[model samples]
Target: MEEEIRVEFTKNGFDFDEEEVILKKCLSFCINYKLSASDIVSSWDVYSLNRGLELTVRSSHMGAFLEQLQNEQLNKVREKESGLHLYSNDVAMILDGEYEEVKEDMLDTPTSKPASANKQPSDSTGKISGSKFSSGKPQESVTPFGQRKSKFAVQSSLNENHIKQIVKVEDHTNSEDDIIKRVRPNQKCTMRIMSSQPKPGCRFMYDRIDDKFNFLENRIKKQAISYVSAGICDEPSDPSIASQKSIFAVGMICCEEEGRLKEKPVLLQSSVEHSGGQRVRLDFQKLNQFSVFPGQVVGVEGLNPSGHCLIASKIIDYVPLSVDSSDDHPSKRQAMDQNLQMTNLSLDVPELSLIVAAGPFTTSDNLFFEPLNELLAYARRKQPQLLVLLGPFIDSDHPELKKGYMNCTFDELFQLEILGKLRDYVEYMGSAVHVILIPSIRDANHDFIFPQPAFDIHPADFNHQIHSTPNPGTFCANEVKVACCNVDILKHLSAEEIFRNPQGGSKHRMTNLAKHVINQCSFYPLYPPAEDVPLDYSLAHEALHILSVPDILILPSDLAQFVKVLSLEARNEGERQIKCICVNPGRLARGEGGGFFAEINYKGNPDSSSASIIRI
Candidate 1:
């Protein structure tokens, strides 16, 4: 009731009294008449309009108004029916002479604007009520309403040429001995994007369920073929059909209801080629152990006696070997071996040194790029050969951006704060340094899709040293294959997965979480992608495929930062086990404080190659 009254008073541009006697009287009237606060406030508005009373509520007029209200109700009852004795004449007499008296306390003019034109109801300190205090949590600059508004500011108001002004640290020599000497100091490592990245400003919206189904169906079919080719299972059959004998079936794991996965009522959705995309109940109760999520496509040797549920005898969660999509016939380990060949790496040889950092690069309090500047300063001193920066560069969820408080557009912000600084860093660091940028879904200036498009900004003028790739991207540094996805898949899968301990799978929780990406063979395997990520199904099928396991997997996540050299053993005889170095560089600036960045010495040899997660 008070909340409603507060809103009305705020809208009306009236000062809310400290003692709140007027507010108390309004509450009293509501209790007596069993009316809502809005109704009572509306009556007060009508009273003010009728009598030409001052807009502000006064104590003297408040009591008389209450009496007048009671009298009006009694009069209405008397006119409608025979209820004369139910009302009291004493209440009607209260307004006889006191109605003449009313009054002020203009309360002085407010320091800030106080009226209907106000955008956010709450301030950083506290909420504003009427011209005073409002009830609720104090709000930061950001609002929940993510209205896609463009033309935030004109070009004249923004500094578009800030990229030219980034300065290098004094006494910072660009010579060999000046570089930060390490175990594997530095070397020539060319960065090449491997995946078919989405173009900047490409379409990702208006996707229907069919587009989504097509991606899932394609995955199931591919997995089925892989299982068969690897000679691990028989030809795939429909689990939905009735069979007394065990059959080789390939399908995706799903829940019966539209919610989190539980043990019972698990369902398997077969591909269109085999089961016409049919869904059947999965009875895992008979099986002692298993691990599955909604989007995982698996081969199962199982029986469906009643045709309603699949009773599994053995489940193949992962395809032991991978087929090179580029090749017609498979070469077990030749392709991967060729990619990993860095020739020779002695202790004295110059190795590839890189600094990997993710965003929002600025602190939440302001967009000053202090943390980013610090990172660049550190990078310049270190003089790393390669620099990989991921985005939410101009974060949409940023308080200032969401509140529309900045004097420039999102594009302008990115140009000034991120791209500008990066261009400067490259120029100062000289030709030896190359930068690889990957966009995030939260990047306001770029396309907000999971298989996100690269930033539209051109970097040819910067000696072609700086460039961008789509989210969930794969690239090569020298001969070392690096696959990096800006999306927080570890956190996403952690929230959605029904993880159970399978045989020989017990390890670090972080490793287990990250292994899902490699084992599932997709950058993002969550069926219904996280509520926050704008997973574009049309582009995801082509973009999300991890065709060849990368030598280094950069999966930046909100989870705790680590540098793990994971050993994924090949399940098939012909294929060789892969040792992948997974690095979550963490965010350079976490919330309002500094976080971490990864300094990678990519020897491309897991035994020799090592990474350290250093605090900013």
Candidate 2:
């Protein structure tokens, strides 16, 4: 069998001269599992090997053998791509792969050369020669939305073009020195816990059915009335009142039954309680283009002659932004002026830099927080005025945690492993660097509820530099109102969303997901939250609402990280559309390796602001 496997591998262009032992092991395992040597060899190629192999064999031994082969193949790719060596046993487990036991050690060491050292320098046009951070130089100013620019191509050296541009902007004013002098080294900023907490005498319980129903009704009314006033839809009427002829009706889309998402009948419930508060079955066979998720308040034009079914001819999702306005609209200009004034009054300088990262701080293989440490080191180097870190600080789903393999309690592990490192970080960076910590539902050491309380850590020795906020937290930094939520809403929405026209346009799915969040004006707007999320409907009324559109919305998700400028038009005409920067700074750790974070230099305007997604 080994001989046959060798012959098949040779025919398939596999070079196993230096891996005879591994080749033999693979052959024996394949034979034992009744896997065809020819079939296995056919799946082997230069491209497949370089990209990494994912083969399923019958047993654990076969999995280990395949992992070894994958490691060798990945090494070949790495060597060809960067002339770097991947030592044996330096296997990184594919986070989304089938095998759970395979752990890959991160090969990038502290002594490794910086990414910028290999690159040639470029001119002062904010471009870097031989840099892979971006495909091309970013515009001298911000590019308009819909242009797909690379998000994660940051240079290792501090002298990159972004730094140069910021320095040039700073050089035009003589206020830098004065601003630095005004900011005391160890000053602590106050952090307000935005989400409502259950008081001492209140009973803790899940949302009642009535409360949940009322919440959805309120949301539908607010959105339906906005559409009517905007002239997008006629005055709202009960769906049951519509005749067989074409008519317009405003209602909320929902499934007929709960916990049944696939191939289930969809119903449209009218906004008005009068006319018996009717629900009409929706028929979508005629609509040309549409995307609808449960709990969406939409305007539909169709015929409901029988008062039982509405055959929808057109679906009108509320327009997120008006295309009529330019980047320099008069209302926008006025708002910018106001922001500048507020910024000047709030701080010593008009500009502020911020670093944002979300956690599962430790890698999958072990409890060592190499990624978190590297992030803090980078933060210290940048010395941003504010650092925002979102959680699952003590991730509840970690392999070690799930297996119950630990020497101490969950709280002890949190204090020693999570907070200890943070305490040291703030102490080293000094009090001028404000640290904002937001909790998550998956955090083991904290409350498991959705509208969670802030971490109650009172270190007598350290100053109030470390600020803890609730799960869906909000705060102000240098006049910028920042709102952040740690739930993976993108994944939740994507899984449950039904798009009638999947290939409709050039708009990215992520952009549409963000638009839904902003238009709905709620943190977790999905009616029936994902099972993993612990949502409390009572507190959700006050806690989940976005009081006003925030300047920046930080929604960390399991989806691909993105930094986008979302422009939302106001309901009133002639008023400027609200513009927001939405960022999902991915997780800090993916499996057993470092991931990415974001940095922003806000100068009171989205166009003038500069931001980047950098790998740890």
Candidate 3:
């Protein structure tokens, strides 16, 4: 333990040349307090943070720092005796960056006696045993003000598969089975990653966002035109202008205030050219059932009787896609199938195995990164062809980070703790293994924006085996194209969206949220983007657009972890009915306990793919 303390001090910029006094004090504190070496190091950081000074290398300042820490320990005892509890309001005070205000309030108020004198002392890790402090406790589950989540029961399924193999990603399509191709190791990596919208540390104009929104409106209108030609939708009219007769209109769905979409306040903001980005309240009382959220571009057939509101008769949430004409030519397909059998040909396709995990990689109770280390261990053992890691690697919301307890810059922390292990993993695993690192807006070390840019890596760290993509980016692993965005869009949408007669339970309701992203062709279709998401509308057109529907869409969230297969209702001439697998590999660490990851094996089509959610 003494050696560990010495090493920690050295890492924190202390050297044994004249720092033995500091090391001894740290050791003594650890022994006296029953804190681990890591805890002692964390204490030093907290002490420095509170003092508003860099950690002193000189032992001359050590006494004051240790004194402050000792005081904090005494305060904890007082808190325990008083049985102080932090209600939601107390949490809000910290989130609002009013720490001084909270301190003043505490000073003015007297510590009250315990509500229950019978209450025993709480464990140090709150509830979890063997826990240590992380930077700060960032509320992963708390939604921003105005964005409130209503209680809805999810038809339980993900819970049943906890710690068990879901086994296979089966294609339930009624079509005949396709030909099987044998799996083999690839000579070179064919994985293609696309992350072009925004560059790291780049600047974007706040004005261009309006233009981008205008452009998106036009884009959706163009898409709707095809439906118009197919007689599926009538030509769109301006919902902004007064129209009493039933008219089909197209526009983006939005909430009037900075809150959830209830029935009355729903607004449809039309394209610039049509209604000049004007918004008209939408009355959904006429429609029996529908789901609506911000940013969802829809073609609605409705009457605008008062010119102030559009009473929707029917809502077309997404444009339709047609399957290829070959389905219309069954005989020709059968002949081609026979010809393949007669030729006795072989099409050796590469089968892919993937391991995907999302972040908050460390358990909430500590910065040990035990969960991440374990995940890496699992990846090393599995040796999957591809490993996808989503970020907030160093979560900005952690309680330690929130309270300014860190001793290092986020970048240095990432390089040392995150990339260091990854570097070793790649070196040991060799080039055969590929890793994809996608950043989140919540990653403190990275740029902060939706369609977030990739993390800037050192030139030395830029190896072929590891790749970085923007948040809400896409890539191909062999023939499987994947779209991944780290934001908890599921939670965001759930908080904001309003639905009625949702055919499926909350599980399917969650899937509908995923559907909104694909249908709108944007990674985050919720308009008035969630309070936490710093969505620069300027880059949104390019960054948010989904050029092609990926085979796998990874939308990680606080919601239940599940692997689901979703199919499109529309069919396009060139493309078949689009079907993709959506996987939410929950967080690697859920609060203090372990969370989940996804193991995937795909042999070309949805029919041959298999996926499961497993506990870490």
Candidate 4:
């Protein structure tokens, strides 16, 4: 195959000395274009000989080579633009440049349009024309606030026949068993709130404030000591010890004053108080890279000759995951397995299916919650055993809520709009479907703090099927242990993180964010959380910690939704390795349109489990 490609290239007035490199580039191009080797050779022949252009393959620069090839073909078409010819539909369109006419013709006779018409042309001009065609669809102009009018402007006037066609329910299942299974009322499920849920009147007092600040300092000190034990850093040192030459010191990053903007100069407060816990200003100008949000415990190697500002030479913000020798704990492993036997009954089920969504369920235009209605309809059709909904049920930021425009209070709005729909859904789906609701900080009707408590719903009949858990909550569905929080930690981390390695691999940012959560062993690990996130440090110890690696981690964020299976290496050699499936089911509504949700199918094994981020 390689010889054939090389010979064909030579025949077409093209030559390359590095045959292997050229072959690899050709292979990549073929894979990207979904073309076979023969197709590539044939295309090159036509492009080189008939088009009267000498094709050159740059072995080291595939992008440039392909660009040159495309430009050459376009030039040929331009040269022949004056002459009208009955070429293939694609070439003819390119020569004539009558995209609007073609689009109108196709739209006028959809059934008659050939399959080839749907194949998008590859040139830049064709892409622009295609985008223009899409934008020209019958869409109403946007409002000043960027809200779009409903696409179904004439929905009220549409007849039953038109409605039926529009809402046609296509059979999505390939087989009966592929359908989502329903949850039995007596189905064994265990929900445990691992995070501390602040009881009413538990915070805001002076004592609570003191506890929170103490919790922050203690947590940072514990983490710093752990780093020292792991040989990742030395013991904590007073900031005053920093000298003319670079010296390592461990401390928590903080602003010199409370309520200081993030742009203000940061201070490093030593965990160990010496000279009354001296605070030194951090000079990051000398550091090549670092990420230090306020309240983050980090080790810095720097100098402060005048004992005023510590010019950081390097910053280490994270401690490595601990590892231990595998051979040292056979008996301990056996005892752990025995303990697992006692708790494995709930996990005996063969399979479990769940539908997960995060909200701001209502669209920006109005509080009708059309998207929520559609999602519930979908859930009913699928009959998922578990429906896990995370919330901003009565979104604090919604225009209606902000304007105080509702006839009822925020609590009434939640009860009527959010819980009402959920109650009806569970009832309609029968006791076989269970629903779990987790609140968000942005929920107007909920407490505006982290470590939020579950909704206080006390309906007699609904108790069995409806469960509410704290914002940063955990539970077990069948054998799958799940942890979820509705905080937008990804957005926070991306904003504050400063990476030294510019050449970080092409791994997705979502994966890195998930890894950070697991590695730090905290629900909201980014310290000095995003401005909107109200973190009460009094409950920090219990509320934020990840007791054990969960089988599923749901960190719903405003960032683009994704489903990823993360494999976390065991810190202890004898410990069972943990693999977690992470999901970010994006907000249910984006502007006036619907966004996406996640569907998970879990059996016993993490590797065998499947999940999808599906658009509503």
Using lDDT as the measure, the top candidate is 1
Q: Give the TM-score of candidate 2.
A: 0.65
Those runs of model 1 whose alpha carbons end farther than 4 Å from true positions after fitting are 1-186, 325-327, 330-351, 502-507
Q: Per model, how many backbone clashes are there? A: 5, 3, 21, 2
Identify the candidate with maximal TM-score.
Answer: 1
Which has the higher TM-score value, candidate number 3 or candidate number 4? 3
Q: What TM-score, computed on C-alpha atoms, does each candidate reach? A: 0.68, 0.65, 0.65, 0.61
**Per-residue lDDT over 1-616 for candidate 1, one digit per residue giving the tens place of the 0 to 100 score:** 7666666554333445443776777777878888775556556654653354544577778767887699768756644563222210112321323322210112335567656226443221122124322233323324321111221111111112321221232233343355343323344556666765676656768678888988888888878878776677778888888988888899999877776563236788999899998998877656676777778888888889999988887787765544553334566456665644443333444347688899978766556566677789888776778889998787766665545433334565566567778888877776667898888877776665678877666865774778777788877766667889899887766555554443344335567677788877889888877787778787877789888677789999876677777788877576566778888887877665677788776653665665677777
Candidate 4's C-alpha lDDT?
Answer: 0.63
The segments of candidate 3 whose C-alpha lies over 4 angstroms from its true place after superposition are 1-188, 204-216, 219-226, 229-234, 240-245, 305-309, 322-350, 402-405, 458-462, 571-575
What's the C-alpha lDDT at position 34 in model 2? 58
lDDT head-to-head 3 vs 4, winner: 3
CA lDDT of every candidate: 0.67, 0.63, 0.66, 0.63
Encode model 2's per-residue lDDT on 1-616: one tens digit a residue.
7777776555333445335665667676576445666545533432232233322222334355566556655655644655322121122222224222221221234466666435322211112113211223233222221122433456222224656687576565435564564354633444444554533223446679888777777766766655654567676667776585788777777888884232367888876453455788998889766777777778888888887888999887663333211225557746865775475467454356788899888776556555676688777656678889998887776666554433334665566556777788777777667788888877776667776666777655564777777668788876677888889877676656666443323235565677777666677778778886777777676667665667788999876777777766575567666778788888887765667788887776565677777876
Q: What order do candidates take by lDDT, descending?
A: 1, 3, 2, 4
| lDDT of predicted model 3 | 0.66
lDDT of 3 by residue, 1-616 (tens): 7788876555443344356676787778888878876567656544543233433455776788678678778866754664432221011223324544543553464577655323321211222122222333233343121121321122223223421343222222213232221122323456787767688777744646457656566566655664565566566688877765788887888877764454237788877666777899888778777888777888888888778989998988775543111123646645764674453244765467788899997765456566677788877655577889999787776555554444445665577668877888877666677889999877767666677888777536537777898887888777568899888887777656666655364336656778888876668777676776777777766777776667889999876677877777644455445677888888887666777888877655555567777777
Tens digits of per-residue lDDT for model 4, 1-616 = 6666665455323566576888877877667666555556555533332222333555555565577556655655654652432111111212234545555654575666565455333111222334431111122233212243442122111123532332343243423343243432334444444444655335532337567667666656666656656575565556676466667787777777654224356888775443355678988777654445565667787778888888888776654444211222547645765676466455454467788989988776566666677688888776677899999887766655443333334665566566778899987787666788888877766677777777777656888778888778887766568899788887666555433322232134456657777766678876667776777776666767766677789998766677777776654456566677888887778766767788776666566666777776
Candidate 4 local Cα displacement, residue 506, angstroms:
6.4
